[model samples]
Target: MSLHTASCRCGAIRFEARAEPFYASYCHCEDCRRASGSPVAAFVGFYTRDARFIGEAPGTYGAAPVTRSFCRTCGAPLSYVDARLPDQIFMMLGAMDAPEKYPPTVHGYVSEALPFFHIADGLPQMETSTVPRPKEDGQ
Candidate 1:
């Protein structure tokens, strides 16, 4: 209902999201682990247009159709935008001012989740990679 603001660790990039995230998830894919240097990467997806970057544009790298933006100063992952999914943006959960407020609703790429990691009880789980489905022609 209310806007939430988030920023990179070095304060190089900042943004605001006008609504609560539609969904949150923890990704255990290898790419995520490599990028985040953690066992998993947590994200909160929002409507792309609802978010506005403040200050300098964060540096971005395209991984095919998807591009990830991060703070050039600190190398902290900030957000992710996929050309294939233009309507949404996934903000790195750690960047949030109140990270605890956006606990993951699901655990994705669970097949690759770390051997020692145990998913919590109630969150949904998906083994394969998942992306937002496109709307039907009629909307």
Candidate 2:
């Protein structure tokens, strides 16, 4: 897989990943919208082990199911990771050096999607969070 490099708007936070993306998607969930200040958010999923911060580490905020890391300088949203999806990290698609490299395959939390906003991309729309919570170890 080709290298994937991304950074915050102020270039304060940067990261590089070598692992192939598990998937790319757009999320219309309220939390995502609130965090992104956009109608929807696009991100590419990769395991945490496959990615790393460059020089400065961004500030992180943990809220229940997920934790988001962003640049303190430019306040650019960077990555979001959910505990339920261990080892997985989702990086904002726009932050990518080559944003076009990852084309979204799905639109998640479509039920929450704004009525005034819709994409004509023809990607699958999931009515809820597409990443199912992992089962217990003994279950």
Candidate 3:
């Protein structure tokens, strides 16, 4: 199986996803913009089981349902995980070793997109994400 590798800007944190990503998108939410320091951010989603840290785990922010992680050494944003989709991890596309291979297939949260920045890719745009999440099973 091919591995998709990624790391922080300083190489202080590394990870690999052993399986194909389930979804990839360009997000325009304010939270993502703030976390990534960009008006738009792209993320590639993988099953949590397919990804693993290469060294010490990265530092994290927020709590529970929506947590963001970053490289403590370089302060580069890394990943985001939501409890609603507990089995998936969304890694920042900019952090990937081969970002060109996993281009965003859709634009998400367009309602929140900055009016000054526009993408004319003609790809599907959604007011919210179209990525599928596993149905919750009562624990």
Candidate 4:
């Protein structure tokens, strides 16, 4: 099994995933843009069971349903977890050691995207989350 590694800017926090990601996408929501301090943010999603944090624990913020984590030392955003998808964790693409390996397949929250920052990638753009819901839930 191949391993994917990611770390914060100061290397105070790190992440490891032993399996391939389930999804990768660019987010244009205000929450994501604010957290990342960017016009748009990209993420790579993995099963929570397949990913883990190592070295130092990350600082977290947000309400119960959604939590965002960052490196306490460097203040670099690291991960985002939503209770709705308990099995998944989304890591910031920019924080990855090799971000080129996981290119975003879609653009999510297009309705909230900054008008000045157009998405010209030709990828599927959705007004809602691009994360595929489990078939069993039929959501």
State each model's CA lDDT, in order.
Answer: 0.85, 0.90, 0.91, 0.93
What would you estimate as the lDDT of candidate 1? 0.85
lDDT of 2 by residue, 20-77 (tens): 8888999999999999999999999988888898978899997867999899888999
Model 1, 7: alpha-carbon shift in Å?
0.4
Q: Model 1 reaches what TM-score against the true structure?
A: 0.89
Question: Which stretches of candidate 1 lie above 4 Å from their native place?
Answer: 134-139
By summed lDDT, the worst window of 10 consecutive residues in model 3 runs over 130-139
Q: Which lDDT tens digits does candidate 3 get at residues 1-139?
A: 9799999998989989999999899999988999999999999999999998787689999866789999899999999999888899999999999999998999999999999999999989999866755566753
How much is the lDDT of residue 98 in candidate 1?
Answer: 91
- Can you rank all candidates by TM-score, best first? 4, 2, 3, 1
After superposition, candidate 3 runs with Cα above 4 Å error: 133-139
- Model 4 compared with the native: what TM-score? 0.93
Per-residue lDDT over 1-139 for candidate 4, one digit per residue giving the tens place of the 0 to 100 score: 9799999999978899999999999999999999999999999999999999999999999987789999999899998998879999999999999999999999999999999998688999899889855455564
The C-alpha TM-scores of every prediction are 0.89, 0.93, 0.93, 0.93
Give lDDT for model 2: 0.90
* Minimal lDDT window, size 10, model 1: 129-138
Ranking by lDDT: 4, 3, 2, 1
RMSD of each: 3.1, 1.9, 2.5, 2.3
How many clashing pairs per prediction, in order?
0, 0, 0, 0
- On TM-score, the candidate that comes out on top is 4
lDDT of 3: 0.91
